[model samples]
Every structure is written in structure tokens, then in C-alpha cells.
Target chain A: MSDTQTTVEPVRMGRKATQPLLIVNDLVKTFGNGVKAVDGVSFTISPGETVGLVGESGCGKSTTAKLLLRTLDPDSGEVKFGGQDLLGMRGRALRRLRSRFQIVPQNPQTSLNPRLPVRSSIEFNLRAHGVPKPERVERIAEVLEQVGLPGAYGDRFPHELSGGQLQRAAIARAISTRPELVICDEAVSALDKSIQAQILNLLAEFQKELGMAYLFISHDLSVVEHISDQVLVMYLGRIVEDGTGSQLWNRPGHPYTEALLSAAPGAERERIVLVGDPPSPANPPSGCTFHTRCPIAIEACSTKRPLLKPTAGGSHAACIRTTDLQQP
Target chain B: MTVEAQAELVIDAAGETSDAVLSVRDLTTTFTAGGQRIEALRGIDLDLYPGRVSVLLGESGSGKSVTARSILRLYGASAIIGGSAVFEGRDLVGLNEKEMQPIRGSGIALVPQDPTGSLDPVRRVGAQIVEVLRLHGVVDSKKEAQARAEELLGLVGLPDPVRAARSFPHEMSGGMKQRVAIAIAICCNPTLLIADEPTTALDVTVQAQILDLFVELTSSIGSAMLMITHDVGVAKDLADHVSVMYAGRIVEQGATSTVLDDPVHPYTKALLAAVPTPDVPRGNLIPIIGQPPVSGMTLPGCSFAPRCPVAQSSCTELVPELVSVELGHSVACPVATEFGAA
Candidate 1:
């Protein structure tokens, strides 16, 4: 683990010296039905940094990504990308900003158009960004090759390609615009394990070559752990813990984070099986939302909500008992 | 006896005779779609021993699900299935729908992948389980069936069994619906349970709970389980025996620890290596090159030879048989079997 950490040291050190690429401050989004999908989440992503956002179903991880991209307008928050207020931008302004940001969704099968060939799908993004038609073909071919697909594959439809091939094409489309940031919302989750590794490795290689920041969102912790520099653990529309991959994986501060880390297969940590499913976002438990399922929930947990405070592990954890719990 | 000792005792009891609740040998299934015969499963050999879990591990289109479906004779008229699936001295392969009726739920039950899809959306979750119980004749009275359904709901760790029983499949969350599906599958106390990627659609925490429920229920009932999944972690966590499938054939079969920890077949090794594990450092995965061959695509020799890292000339000339490398461990690569020993 240390050797792996050392290998990624240069990437971390290079990014730390530079100003952050994107800064999300107190972002909040509540649906029409009174479901607070994202609540008061704040994080920063540096240039070429891969931030892994992990949570279970309805944990607001996807909602946060949507809010960042302004796909769904945030109820209230500040999203500053490249030092510009992204939330303030509208219409043509927002569309202009879109060239700098792109998203690769979970299912490549649905994300890609069945009617269009793989080349057109990638070219569509380039076309939208006002790239000349002459350059689109070359860019598409270059991206396809970068993602490990043959240039000839550009002629095939989505149905003609396998799940892995389709995902690579989806990635090719996402990166074709040469966006500064790419929000991959479980982009590799739908693919097979073998293909998942291929995609993960390709993403890592792309990050090194192009120096693009990634908002890698997924439910799979191992995938997150492998790719991310900083990992955020969300529970019930709130950031329960924010730390590095090693910090979250090796020494998770929040009980929810701890339970999640343990739940991941092949985790050597002692299993802390959280009882029951996550409470509905519309009807989250009072005080500490996780108290209902927290293994170490004290009386204070139900009476008072915990604030995200700095812990010994150089991570912020929103758990009242963070100091009391023994470090892993 | 203590819990650990008791668990060991049960394992020993099951291991003594190595009593396979279902023994599938040389099972093949071919589907004729669009005037083309596609081999979905080719010579799949697996055995599910009582009180233990045997996992059919593979990616989509690898015939893991087909194997489960074939065991129950669930395929329609167009499917041409061959070979034997001996359950209780009866071959399930040749059985017609009418013949398989009794065996489907009573002898073997399926907890399908998509819980919502498998469940009756119109019916109440409780009523569905009760219907299965009544249809299988597991319970005589409606009152008894209702009571049993509630008990099963509780057994699956569903909160408020009464409310859960009254709610429809659409009303329940994905995890709850899956639990209901599991409850329905186990209501009859079948000797063998076939869960096809049961937790694939679930969240990690929910998946852990469901898997824990499966282990607890199956152990207590002394039921053999055939757990099909593409996830290596799930197979590692749950399976006693693991069968790695590629292009509709078993490439490797052995104890979970043996196959996962030290795989022989290049495909198996590549599959394990490809998975992103917490222990493994970032950016270190060596992904298997090339996609699995599409169904109906003819391969001259080994199906995995095109993508196999250590393939030689001979690997492309002949499809190797599953040769024993160690006790209870077999690999389908002649090169690996011969060289992997060192």
C-alpha cells in the first residue's frame, strides 16, 4: 500500500502546489417532493486530481455531480470552476462553460445513441463545442485510440460493440472535448470486472497524459480507492467523511464510512454490518441521520447533529463520537 | 457446541459424503435465434453440495445465468439443452415443463437477478410469498401461509414484516424487494437455492446484509446454494467452491481460496488480476486484452486463447480438457496445468 502510495506521490505533489481547479461551497439541492438530495456539501478538486465520491443508494452522490454540472439547478450553492461562478452562468454562458466540463454516465448502453455510429457520438460533443467538422474526425480517431479502441470501431453502432467497447467509446466521447474536468457518474460500474480495470487504467493514463481532473463517482469503494486522491463518503445527503484514499480506507473516522469500508469485499478490516437499509432521504432521521444505524450511536447522536470537524487523521468527519472511537 | 465449532461440524457433515444436491455434468444449451444457433452454455460441469455455496463466476453472456436456468429447465421451446443435471437420482436436463413443475420450487428455487422484474408488481409482497408457499404446498392453510410469509420477511431482516407484507413490490426499496424475493425463494425450504447475481442490483451495505441473510438461512436450512455472479469479491466472500466461466465454458473450478488466491488458468488469473481490490495499489491492474467472443462466433481452439497472456501455438490448436492440478482443483489450460505446478 505504501509503495502504491509512493507511485502516486508525484501527481499529488504537483497538484498541491497549484490552485484548485474547482471549488464547491455549501452546495444544496432539494427536489420538488421535499427530498434533500444534496445538503451542504463542500469539496475542492485540483487540476489533474481525481476525487472519488462514494455513497449508497439515495446518498446524494449523483445529485452532487448533477449540481456541479448544473444539469439540475441547485437550490442554493456556489460552484466555482476555473475561478468562475458556474452556478451564476446561464443559457449561452452556461453552454460556453460546458466545453470545459463533461459527464460520462453509468450505463454506456443508454448514454450512447443506438442509431448513431460510435464516431458520430464522439464527434457530437466536438460539434457542440463548435470544433470544426474537419478537426472532429481527427479528434474522434485520436480519442478512440487513446481509449484503446481501434479507429475502425468508430464505424460500428452501439449494438455491434460489446459492453467494454461501448464504455471505451463513451469515455472517448467524454474526453474528445478535452474538458478540464470530467464527472464520471459510475461510468465503469455497468461494465465487467475485466473491462472495469481496463477503463480505470485508461482513465488513470488519460489523467497523467492530459492532466484532466475527474469527479469519479461510484458505489464501488475498491474502484474509488484505486483511482482517487481524495475520497468523500456521503450518507443521507450529507458528507459524513472527507479524506484521502488511504485516510478513508485505512482509518475511516465516521461510523458510516467505517461500515461502508468494511462492507466492501476483500476489505481486511473487521466487519461492522450496519443494521437495516438507509432511511429515506425525504424522512431522514433527526439529529445525526446515521444514528438509527450507527453501531456506536450514543444518546447525543439522536439529540444533536454532528458538524464536520477536523480529526487526527487529517480528515473531516461529521460524527460526534469521532474522537471517542479507536482509530483503525 | 460453540458457533465456530458448530459451523465446522456442519461443514464436516456436508463434506463427509460430498453429497451433491445437484450435479451438473457436460451441460450444454444452444438457442436458435434469427436462424442462427448460438451456444449459450458449452459443456458446463458443476456440483452444488448441500450446506455449501457453489458459485458460477463469469461476466455477462458467459452462460452463468443460463446454467442456472438450464438446471431448472426454465428455457422455452427453442432451446436445445443436452447432458445431465442429476438431482435426487433424476436427470433434470431432459425433463419437460410439466415434469419440472414439482422440482422447480420444492427441490430448487431461484432468487433472480432483477428483484423488481422477477416479482409480481401488482401483487402485495406478502401475498406473492404466500402464493408460492401455497402453490408449492409448503403450507396448507391461508393463515399458516400468511404467518410463514411474515416469519420469512422477518428472517430476511425486513423491518415491520406486517407493513412489508401489505406493501407492493413497487412500494418497497430495491433492497427490500430483493429480500422479499429471497424470502419467496426460501419459503418452501428447498434443498438447493439458485441465486443469479442476487445482489448485483443492490447497494454495497444492502448487498452485505442480503448476503449475510443468504448465508444464515442456507446454513440453518442445510440447503446447497448455486450463487451466480460476475463479481470476484462476492464469489470470494460467499462461495465454498468457485467455477470460473468464459465463453460458455468452465475454465477453472476449485475451492474459493485455491482458485482466487492462486489461479492456474490464464483467464482465471487475468479475471482475478483485473478486479480492483482495496489491498492492491492504484493503477496496477493488468486488464485482460480483447473482449469475450460473441455467442455463435466460432473459435478454432480455446475460447480464451485469443486473450490469454500465455497462449502458445498448441492452445490455438485444441480445446483443452479440465485437468486436475490438485485435489478438488481443476484448470482447462494444458500449459497452465503442466507449468503452473512449478
Candidate 2:
């Protein structure tokens, strides 16, 4: 927040034709003298893509989101958006970038101001981007219609609506300014499955309509699978695996990824059960972060850090034993 | 006289069946808020057979817990429960707190959600177990209570029972704390155990372990169980019988597989479709478009028609009661015969 310091990146802007709509490479962030909150994480999302970022608590998925948004300061690496270095933006430059990106944060009940009515909440986003008040009502109405709520519901307070309805109002607020990239942070985790389905469907529909991208963050794999075009699996402040939703869920490469999929309630995993809790991120293992809990862990996996490598297709996993990880 | 005897013989049609442990007939509870009456239950008819797991599945605010608390007489004297909830041929609905005290924790018990929260934070878990035993008059001696507590811990698959018995709730994991709650629920060897969202707070692997323990313990003791949960998957996997509740009433009831696999009521079908099943691949999911009616919400006909896709004009005008469709299946919907179940 200081005026003098700025978010500067070391890497040069890559090619323009296929620049990642959002690029987060080797993003390292730490808390007050704490361990790496986001350790060596990398992912890229193009236009109209929905990338699901999933993991259990303390997996640094939330940390990665903050880094991408530039709300939190990263110790190293770069966050690039639109073939432009996002890490160098300062003050007005950063504020302008924020207009292109918005976040519908977790827990709509607490996210939306209780004192403010739904109408005012929608108007705030438009006003922030200097949209005239005369046109606010029209833009708000369009977003509300997209989420399947009538315009009349706009004047009511968030408390007046049900949990499902309140979330729809939150979604309307996020996209009212038509941001190119939106961050849905556990947007539907608090909602019932039926309500979750509606929100996920609405997100997909909006992506096709607006050609926007999303950084979908959640611990629930079901929601991740339903909405995300590609998926990123994080554990202990690191991205364990990254690939298409099918390859990640149906055929995971990392030991941690397999454990996560198997841990799903009704997944019917092939009798593979993760025994111990994941190691603490603050005091992570020396080499492979997941070796402590890996079931088929090799001796090499414990002492030597493994670089993320391609496995079979447009998928990559960070593990030493490729043969063991590829086992059926 | 001979004709009267023959009629009585046919009236007792269900012969060779075991006597019901807890029978509820026409049970209903209403509340008066702001000078308006809110009917929480409308003539709930149910039976808890010995050693059977009867699941009451419903979404939030569906009166599932009200049914459980009503039998325990926990609604206070002002609740005005109608009809009878017969426990061992005794009308539990009419019993006062003093009269019901001896039965609770002795012949009936409850395993609530958040096992750690269920126990007193300041007291040691071992002492809490002993307190339950003393309350039920199962063991007057402290040594006897402690011994029984250790045994119960072992029964629920806890490791190092002696150490766990002395440990506090904070020292244990979520699964271990739930096991401690189970240990307390079965300490008195009650005839029935009521578990209300016992596994909701735990992870998947831990949930499975706790559920399996419920089956193992209830069967071993021949104690009937009443499990109230929002998850339909667990109901399918665990319950022998399932009762689907919506808008403070049982809309459907039958064998678990039959009810879940071929649900009749539109509400039941919608509720089942809501859960994201892993067996079913990722695709477009069918979600009920609208919210369930809040308490005291009423329409001209069916409660679920507001969100039901197949709702007809007639469905909005006339309320329907449970209609028998087969030997065990029953549904409360006018369009039950027409709706093609999933």
C-alpha cells in the first residue's frame, strides 16, 4: 500500500498471439516470517477459460488467488495478464487493472454489506468504474437477468432473500461491470447442491456469452469438475498436478492428487485411502512436499525435489517416479 | 359371536412380525408465533423396529429434528403434542420432564452433530462418560463407570482406550471425538439411538468409519436407530427404511433402495437429483429451480408445485396425501402415477 514500493516482475512479456489471459508462474508468498504460503505454483488461463483451483485447507489455493489479484504481496515470481506485466502496476495503473478483474468472494452473507441494500451493492461496482448513475439501473438489470432473478428483487435487502437468492445477488454484483476475469472464491460452497448447480450453470452460460475467464477456487471437487474447463490441484502451498478436468479427476498422476480424488465421499476410489494428514506447509518436507503422506513413495522422492513434467497428454505432475505415478 | 371373532382375526393381518419398539401414531406439533399458528408436523405416522436403522432424510428446516425431540419430550410442556408416541407401549408424548428423565439415556439416547461440542469443554471426556452412566443408574461406583467407559471406547474402534478415556476433546481429531460421542450414546445400552447429522462435520473417510460403527454397534446390541440427515447418499447406503420429509410432512416412505432408486414424490425426486454423484460423470446437473417453501408457506394445492417442472394446474389447487402404490412404497402427490421416476 506504500506509494514508493511497487509490484515489479523480472520476466519479460511473452508472445502476444497466445499470451496467457492470466499467468501466475513460480509465485512465492509468505506470511510474517512464516514459511512459503504459495510455494512454486504455476498455471495459465486463456480467454473464455474456467480454471478450477482445488485443495483442502492450508493448500494455498486462496493464497494463489490473492497473489493473482495483487491484493497480497508475493516474495518472487510474476503474475501476468493480457501480455502485460501485472507485477509492475502501481496506484492508478493497478486500479485500472482491477476494473478488468473482480472477485465474488466466499460467503456472500458476509461479503455483501448487510447495511446496504442489493440495489446499492450493484451500483457500487458501476460507480467504482466511473459508470454514470443514469445507466447503472440498466446494467444491473442485465446482470440480474443473467442470473435468473427478476429486476424487482434488486431493491430488496440481502436479508430479505433466501441463501440461494442472496448468492445470485452477489453474482450479479461481480459481473455488473463486465470484468474480463472473475474470481469465484468458494462461491457456492455455502449453498445447497441444487443452488450450487444453478450458480455453476449460470457461470458457464456467462462465459459463453461474454467470452470471459474465471479463476474458480474451491475445496469441493464436484463443483470444480462441473464448471472448470481445466483444473489445478494444490497441497501444502504447492500445485501438485495440473490438467484437464477429466485427466485430473479420472486419471491423476501425483500421489497427493490420487489421495484427494479417492477422499471424495462417493468417488468409489479403488480401495486407496490416504492414511495421515498432509504435512504442515510451514515445515514442509525437504524435497517432494507430499512424500510424507505418499502411499507409493520412492526413496528418490524424499530427498530430490522433482520438477513438474508432462505425463501423457496436455497434463503435468510434480513427482519423481513417473512409472509409479502412471500406474493404473 | 363367531362372526365377530372371524373379523378380529383378519384385522390383525400382520402376524408373525416382531412387536414395534417405538410406535408413533398421528403425531403433530404446532407453534403460535405472533398470534399465528405454525404447524411443524401434520399427523406423522412412523415405527422404529428393534435393531433396524430408520432414516429420516430431508433438507434444512424440514422438521426432522422436531420428530426426534418430540419423542424425548424436549419441546417443553407448551408444545402441545397431539396423538401418541408409544415407547414400550407407553405414551411418550404425554410424559412430563420428570417422568421422561428415567427413560432418556437409559432406554433412549442421541448422538448429535459436532461431537466435541456435544461434550462439556471443561470436563474430561472420561468423567463425562461416567456422568451419563450415573445419570442412567447404570453404575453408581466411579470405578465401575470408568471401566464401562473404556469398554465402550474400544467398542467404537478407538485406539489406546485407557489414554483416550482420560484425554480431553481438544486433544482428539474430529473422527476420534465423534467416536467418543458414540461411546457416550451407547454407554447405557439403550434400546434406541437417535443420531442427528453425526457425520456431517467429518470428512469422507471418517464419515464412512463412523457410519460403519453405527451399523456394527446397533446390530450387536439390537438397538433400533433413527438417523436424521440431509445427505441422500448416506441414507441410501445405511438406512434399511427411508422416510422423505418436505414442508413438515412425510411425502414418501418405503424401503431405502425402492424409495431412492424409484422415488415417487416430485420433491423426493428433486432432492435426490441435487446431490452430485461421482458415479455419474460431470455434465449438466438437474437442479430444482426454486427454493423450498418456508415454514407456514402454503399454496392452493401441492407444497412443491412452485418448483416442480411437471406441475400441472390441478397440482396448484388440491393438496394430496400419501397414496399406497405397492406393498411398501407410498407417495403424497396427485401426479405420482404420471411422473416417470428417475
- Writing each residue's lDDT as its tens digit, candidate 1 over B1-342 gives 222233334346543333567767789999998999898888987777778998899988899988988888888787999988878767887777888999988899999999989998899999999999999888889999999999999988888999999999988889899999988888888999999999989999988888888889878999999999998888888888899999889999888999999999999888888878666766778898888888888687899989988899998899889887877788899988887774
Candidate with the greatest TM-score versus the true structure: 1
Clash pairs, candidate 1, are none
DockQ (C-alpha based) per candidate is: 0.63, 0.31
Residue-level error in angstroms, candidate 2, position A101: 1.9
Chain A alone, model 2, TM-score? 0.92
lDDT of 1 at B176: 91
lDDT of 2 by residue, B149-233 (tens): 9988888888788998989898888888999999999998899899998988875545766777888988999999999988776
* lDDT (10s digit) by residue, model 2, range A163-238: 8888899889888888888999988887766677777777877887777788999887767877777788887888
i-RMSD of all predictions? 1.4, 3.0
What is the Å distance of residue A189 in model 1 from its true position?
Answer: 0.2
How much is A51 displaced in model 2, in angstroms?
1.1
**Candidate 1: lDDT of A311?**
73
Residue pairs in clash, model 2:
A7-A87
For each candidate, give its TM-score against the true structure. 0.94, 0.87
